[model samples]
Target: MINGAHVIIYSQDAEADRAFLRDVLGYPHVDAGHGWLIFKLPPAEVAVHPAEGSGSHELFLMCDDLAETIADLESRGVEFPDPPEEARWGILTTIRLPGGGDLGLYQPHHEPAYDL
Candidate 1:
């Protein structure tokens, strides 16, 4: 039976990234001891899109309000390298993470599947 999913982000500066996730993003977490932190994410979902050629997987954090969410994160010292772009799917932009990484965050235009 399929259970929940666990996503891992490999970071060059793991401590800093953990700090960013804990302090800045404010995702409640527990230490696995020795400073290893496991964060609890908000509700999540997965969708598959067909591609022509082989492609890698990607992760995106979905939100309800794009502007408001961006404002809140920005206030927490998060950086957005590009402005949000509107598409049929949603409004999206990349949020800069520690160690020169980025995470995809978007406000979805489609109906959420949380009820299912």
Candidate 2:
């Protein structure tokens, strides 16, 4: 039986990124030996969308209110590369990670399946 998912974010500056997640985002985690920290995510859901090619995946952190969430994150020194924009499914924005990568953050207009 399936149990859980482990998500990996490849980083150019891993230590800095780890500190960002730990100190700024405040995601609970355990030290998995040798200073490797594994974060515990909120409830998750998976979806499949048609594409012309394969071997690609995305990660998005969802929130109940995008405006409020953005404000909170900004106060914590999080940077958004762009403002939130509307989509058929949600209002989306990109969070700039300390590792120089972007993570998606969105407030969904469609019902989420994480609770199901």
Candidate 3:
């Protein structure tokens, strides 16, 4: 069985991205050798939505309180996709990552990928 998968993001400002993931998102992570940082992310839900020529990875994270999460992030100077909308299968919102890639925040309507 597949245990888990780690999505690695390449950023020009890797340190800043690491801090954002750990500080802003409040996810526990570690800095590996050779200037690589690994984030211990929650179980994956959404699949990778690759952008043409961009190579950006899109992930959907399950949240307990979408409203509260959004509020807290916004207060911390994070710019979320204006007017979050409910997609067919989930709530979709976009966040700007440090390296100009868009991060998707989603609360799926179907069963969550992991237990809350």
Candidate 4:
């Protein structure tokens, strides 16, 4: 029975990346020092390695507005691969995370939280 887990981002630019996550996206985080910064991420419905420029799993965050989320992320200096695209499953978008990880932002087709 698993309760909680933390996703770690290994970044070459640790401090700047941490600041980006905290200031731009407004995610709460704690600096542990020694090349590690911990971000208080939301509950995980899915998991993946977000490392950019490497063969890694994709990370997606379910958001309210696909366009707004994209815009906000862009404004905060997050690089998106492309514009939002709607698919049968959800609205898929992309962003470059602090640890050179690729972030996929999506809004699911069904309201899982509401249903459960």
State TM-scores per candidate: 0.91, 0.96, 0.77, 0.72
TM-score, ranked from best to worst: 2, 1, 3, 4
Residue 12 local lDDT, model 3: 74
- lDDT tens readout by residue for model 2, 1-116: 97899999999998988989889988999999988999988778888888886668999999999999999999999999999999999999999999999999999998889876
- The lDDT of model 4 is 0.73
* Residues 1-116 of candidate 3: C-alpha lDDT, one tens digit per residue: 98777776766777777878888888976768875668888776545564779684446666766777888888998887556788897777777776566677766787775655
- TM-score, candidate 3, is 0.77
Worst 10 residues of 4 by lDDT: 43-52
CA lDDT, candidate 2, residue 70: 99
Off by over 4 Å in 3: 46-57
Q: Tell me the tens digit of each residue's lDDT in model 1 across 1-116.
A: 97888899877788888999899988999999999999999888888998878967888888999999999999999999999999899999998888678889999999878657
Among all candidates shown, the one with the greatest lDDT = 2
Candidate 2's displacement at residue 38, Å, is: 0.2
Could you give the candidate ranking by lDDT, starting with the highest?
2, 1, 3, 4
Candidate 3: which pairs clash? Answer: none
- Cα lDDT for residue 2, candidate 3: 83
lDDT against true structure, model 3: 0.73
The sequence of per-residue lDDT tens digits that candidate 4 reaches over residues 1-116 is: 98776666666776777877787878876778784667888666653545668665445677877888777777767888767798988888877767676667887787656334
Of the pair 1 and 2, which is ahead by TM-score? 2
